[model samples]
Target: MRESRAKSVWLQREPSPAAAARVFCVPHAGCGTGVFRNWPPEHGPVDFLPVELPGRLSRFGETMPATFEELAADMIAGLERYMDVPFAFFGHCWSALLAYEATARLQRAGGPAAARLFVSSQLAPQDGPVGRMLGMDEAELAGELEAMIRDQGGTPHPELVAVYLRVLRADVEMSRRYVVPDPLRLTCPITAIGWSEDSEVRPGQMSGWPACGDTSFEVFAGRHNRFVDAPRELLTTLCAGMAGRGPSRLPVTSR
Candidate 1:
């Protein structure tokens, strides 16, 4: 079942009597749980719960996060419950940085850390956000936003487009202002996913991930926003990590 409390949105739809591991999904900036709306609540034995950040969608009245670190900190308290059992995190694009920081914060607090960290359609946490979205003006950004919405097969009216733009601008600004801190080693594995046709982040740009943990790279078929649709390959990749305890018995982050 899905629950929207003060800090985060837990999008688990399963009412299974017995629970297994869970996968907490974090959306890219300006996006919401709507991205994973079509994904099943249970992928095999694991449950899927997508995290809805504050100030977006149902949390529209909340303040937008100032930094990746700050956002992660805000969500940690609410995320504590899922940690009672084995759980991991899945983040795409901007959420990759947020997830990494959140995982780190969890480790620093000596809390139940995530089983794994799956990052898709993005570069390493140290690589940061780089793209045409960085310098685009209002007109260019508007066009880009419309193109993205249309690519996802949605026809957006001008008024609705403006509403999205307001959030998009703030999200992009956060990305621009972000600076990846010195890398800290984490016990959990880090998987960086790339798309062969993705124009935003390429395979070569996905290096430097080992700074975070024992890292691996996987390539799937699609574009930058592919994860928004929750493709099969992406779900399968995530399900692989969700199945059981990885090489590390307990994941941690070291300063």
Candidate 2:
């Protein structure tokens, strides 16, 4: 495998070959590593590596995965090169399940194992998906898109929104048809983060995540998209968890 290929695919604000540990983050649907652009400043103990999925953002030239299997395969292939160091996984929304499955795939492939798993604003793999975006028409989706952009602190320009809509529609359709997995339990600890104000996903919905492993739940103050901008609180907890030492308590800002 070409080492440079993984470098281009994963976004690390501070490229640290000397870090003690690494945290590879998986973004939500239609999200890119751009969210972590301002995080983890240089010299952090753990390397903050945010993965950019194919078919979106900088990877627009690649075809998007049509199903969960394809997504997992793509992740396994692309990330196998980075597993030499002690690492953890963090993912949000629908992609959180993707991260879990990818971790399993890594172990199955005789690749590296994650030190920890952090899934936020999403249910466990057994619960399946819970959104109606798949059934919405383009017009309805456009309306939702505009509102979503506004909530994320951005004004959607027509052309840009159109492109975003395309990626979102594909992502939603993929999620809607997804089959929940009978996941493999990990030896590592799992952390489920609930967004206090995120009506889309409640803390109870993610309670099942503990079944995957030795899991803990923490709540942060924010809506569903709060982590998109890479909040300081979120980064701190992730860095600590991936550091692979000391107490593993997460700072909870909410229930």
Candidate 3:
């Protein structure tokens, strides 16, 4: 019953039983697994499992997690069964911090530790609560949300935007309240990925990650949201990173 509940609430779909390894993808603030709908189900031996956090999409109306610690605990509980295999966590933007917190806690819990934690376009915890959205007021956040919808070629409905605005505000507040002066160094290595065109988080800002664990940094050529498309280059890097191979430093060509 616990496994059934975890599968229904946390994951978008059942994981690939035959895959050699899995990479659980956590979305950014105010979003759900739909951000990863376009991503391939599997990239060679690695299966991509997009996480579905509460207060969004199918989990809408559920209470949003009040803090990162709560959020991490919930994720760890929901993903316990799936952790039997070699696995990693991939989080983008705000969820990168979530992934880090969960990985740290999971390691200390005497469970299967994550093989790697892949944080994209986010600063290390000690260097944060830093991000443009952290300083934005509700009006500015609403505008930002609208702009994102427009960029995706969708018209933003006022009602939907209003709901997402509340979720966004809560997420932003959670981020603001998260102050990890001295974060726990994880047993797993970290792969910090920076996008060349990401105006929000420059690669230089991610320099503090090495303080957390054995870390490798890679810069891909694309804007902040490009990872949502699950580019081949990014998948290659993740595969190599999980396999304990050194950074490929793949030659950047136009996306």
Candidate 4:
């Protein structure tokens, strides 16, 4: 486990030196490594690394990324020294896009790109915005925010929620304010994961994952933030997928 202020990041690793693949788990905006603290220890096979971005959690003083591209660059640089093993990238929401971008940067930096890219609760870039709250006025945005919480039910701890919400609002501003720098693409395989009830990412839009790489889609019977609502299922799905194996479908029992 290491940290870098240059990139405004913190990270934790549940390492298995003998593991076949290194799994990098990127948290959603306004989230941190604590979100994944319990994950790697319980999952079978593969090492786990949870990233903590600045402007959240303990690193609140560090500058948060203002654009996906910049965040990607920072993550790539931060992880450059650890490219010796086969690795996979898993991210949720804003981090999903970051996973794609970071995979591209790793490739450009002359390393083996992620063996697999797993993205949750987000649409492909060309798919355009879904549930865009940044553009909403304060009152309307609050309603949208509440709807998000109601739909996902992964609202952070109340204290953390207040702080994270403030941070998330800033991140939304950043997302809304970003501009694409180049026509970016990746050759790695991508798997789009989202809830059946998630309006943030449409099924047709998930098919667009092919545009990013060799792609597939898996839907769960939940909402936007499946991790918090369903950790075991999420980890099982991710672990199975990372092993180049098929998913073990869970019954439609909402948590």
The best candidate in terms of lDDT: 3
Question: What TM-score fits each model?
Answer: 0.87, 0.86, 0.93, 0.78
Instruction: Summarize candidate 1's per-residue lDDT along 65-128 as a digit string, tens digits.
Output: 7777777887887678557677888888878877888888888888887888887766666666
Candidate 2 error regions (>4 Å): 1-7, 10-14, 41-43, 245-255
| Global lDDT of each candidate | 0.74, 0.74, 0.86, 0.67
Clashing pairs in 3: none
User: Model 4 segments beyond 4 Å from truth?
Assistant: 1-9, 37-42, 139-162, 178-183, 229-233, 246-255
Q: How well does model 3 score by local distance difference test?
A: 0.86
* Candidate 4: residue 109 Cα off by (Å): 2.8
- lDDT score of residue 68 within candidate 4: 77
The model with the greater TM-score, 3 or 4, is 3
Two-way lDDT contest, 2 vs 3, winner = 3
User: In candidate 1, which residue ranges exceed 4 Å CA deviation?
Assistant: 1-17, 244-255
**144, model 2: CA deviation in Å?**
3.0
Candidate 4 has its poorest 10 consecutive residues by lDDT at: 246-255
How well is each residue in 1-255 modelled by candidate 3, as lDDT tens digits? 434543468887888889888999998987778888778988988889999898999999799889999999998898878877889999999999999999988878887889999999898999989988988999999998898777666789999899999989999999999999898888788888999988988877888887888788889899888897788899998888777884734323323
- In TM-score terms, candidate 1 sits at 0.87
For lDDT, candidate 3 versus 4, the one ahead is 3
